[model samples]
Target: MQIKLRLMVALLGLLSVAATAAELPELIFPEGVGVNIHFVTEHTNDLDLIAAAGFKFVRMDFSWESTERKKGEYTWGDYEELTANLEKHGLRAIYILDYSNDLYEERVSSLHAITHEEQRGTASPQHPKSIAAYARWAAAAVEHFRGQHVIWEIWNEPNGYFWKPKPDVKQYLTLALAAAKAIRTQVPKAKIIGPATSGFDWPFMEEFLKSGVLEYLDAVSVHPYRDPGTPPETVTEDYKKLREMIGRLAPGGKKNLPIISGEWGYSSSTAGVLQEVQAQYLVRQQLVNMLNEVPLSIWYDWKNDGLDRGDNEHNFGTVTADLKPKPAYVAVKTLTHELSGYRILRRIEMDPKDYVLVCVNGSGGCKMVGWTTAKAHSVGVEMPFKSVHRITGMDGFGKGFTPKVKEGDLIFKVEQMPKYYAFE
Candidate 1:
């Protein structure tokens, strides 16, 4: 009876994969907005808040050290539960196949065995046997989760301290290539992406792209983070340059690789940015990515990791550690709910400071979101609305007002914070 039940579950998984396999596109938007979360089980309530905000994906680390306690064996029970919980909330998973297993190279005891400052996260799989073991484990994982809308990333931030003992492109590529090859050989339909580099390290990215790894990847994932004062618009040119580099380095069939805004966000630390500014940035960031045609944009954090008001790392969350909704949380909830099923139609730029994004939904409803990085100003935009529509602020607070019209154009106020003007 146990064997029969196991077979039934396996069959169901296969059936689920078969059903959704064909609908997986190279680029998806609005639906691709996600958040990076820390827990899989403990704070299950976070999933409820995440779902309420209309988040479609959750990016989390599927740690290797915890899974492969005994060499040649894997315990995916924790991640299985994580994925199951996410699925129940209508969320997808972007699992980072991360870190070195302590059972192999370096022979550390556990994930928390930190000796010194530099030796932190240095338990990387460098040995030949360890590399092979990691590859086998990756293949086994892909085979096990053969479907159900999970995207696998090879490693996280290999260009930074996450690689251990300094970042080496060659060393990272060796492990990545082996893992990618192993996963592809088993689960041919699996969506694998890699070189999840920290920030936009061009040299490391160019090296990784030139190494012929694109053949195994479905998209180019990156964490395009800028300074606290810098607006998210600064990433526009970087995206253009990265696309060009991908085109030049990728092989024939894989030249037009899509980009994923894997992990990025602003912290509302007391010493740095304001919570209100962070709120504005969150909405702008998602809109910028959507306009640039980025399939997925996973905000670095869903909730603050700690209560420290001065610690930058602890304050990137959209919500507080106690599950209290911050302005950023309300902003994201408002943005997603307001712009659901809408795609950017065009951008009408009047000047360097004025930015207007015309979006259209499936039901022929037109909405415009406009903002400015500089001082507040007004711009005239031609639309099809005959009556005054409700104007919603970035925080989803506003009122109905008739705008001044001239020559079949509606004048819109573009301020630091984005506002949605629905012209249905």
Candidate 2:
């Protein structure tokens, strides 16, 4: 009887595997997924660091204050240097045009002042002339950087830190539309993204959509940063809400406009629980975005800027100031390497479990199931019962995995790896 029971269990497992295998397909790299970095100023060297860390794309801010401090007279020397460097290393730039030039001090101060009312009065859309001037400047900047950078984001977190008046969705959209129109006129082919909001700015987003603000932009941008301790289930819901908002804004495939998580990260410095939760959160978020077909999920600030490396605000970077890889950093590098050259086939959400089963198709007729945990859950991959692959830094290659299949799954657990992966 015991022998018969064991046989039954084995048969059931085999049957399940066979059934899944018939429907399973190889995994391929999803289109347009990327990482963000702040290499515009102090950490210019961090550009190479990011590239070395295996990131193909990087996002940086082109400060209006820095580029055109004076009116009509523009300087591209600094920008030129930065772009030239990125080009040399085969990295793509996603430039965000932020801050107001001194000429628009009244508008900048009024719109972005600490007090909500002061910011609103200063940044009122009534100042169409000033807004138009800024738009014109953006156009000139686009012309200057033409053919060099393709993705240009209008502003950073306009509904939050970027906007001083605090969450005036309509006014922010108005400014964005003005910028978009001006940019479109000059660089018709340029892909413009805007209204980069942080957290659950759904209320502002709803208002923007109601105003038909999405019509002017090519893509919607968001910065979804949960507290470090927030569970993966909550984060996933946040992204879902974001997607729903985007869908309502542009329905019926009218615009298959991609959503870019332009800024996201968790820092150890915030709290002890956050430190533990952030590593898993980073990994889970990346998997969710990719599986759901969000084009880009760029992390904020690749390197620490302050003296306290673990302080939540200062420690949002994937690496320390001197470039030591964090656990979150390792996880991203590993995932990117493993899932490279493969695109997502489909994602299945499991309720109560708070997990997702991501099936991917790739060359050589290989199928991979990426089990993404919502909180801190764990699972092993079955089939292809090879050894685990170890990925080192951004430039390092993937090491071979030992033959170990736990509960009918192959296990290829990792923290981070270089840009290239070598399977042995």
lDDT of 1 by residue, 6-122 (tens): 454345445435324532332224588899999977567899999999899999998888888997888988888888899889999999998887677773322332132533443
TM-score, model 1 to reference: 0.89
lDDT of 1: 0.80
Candidate 2, 291: how far from true, in Å? Answer: 1.2
How much is the lDDT of residue 395 in candidate 2? Answer: 24
For each candidate, give its TM-score against the true structure.
0.89, 0.76
- What TM value does model 2 have? 0.76
Clashes of 2: 36
Off by over 4 Å in 1: 1-29, 107-116, 120-122, 385-407
Each model's backbone clash number: 0, 36
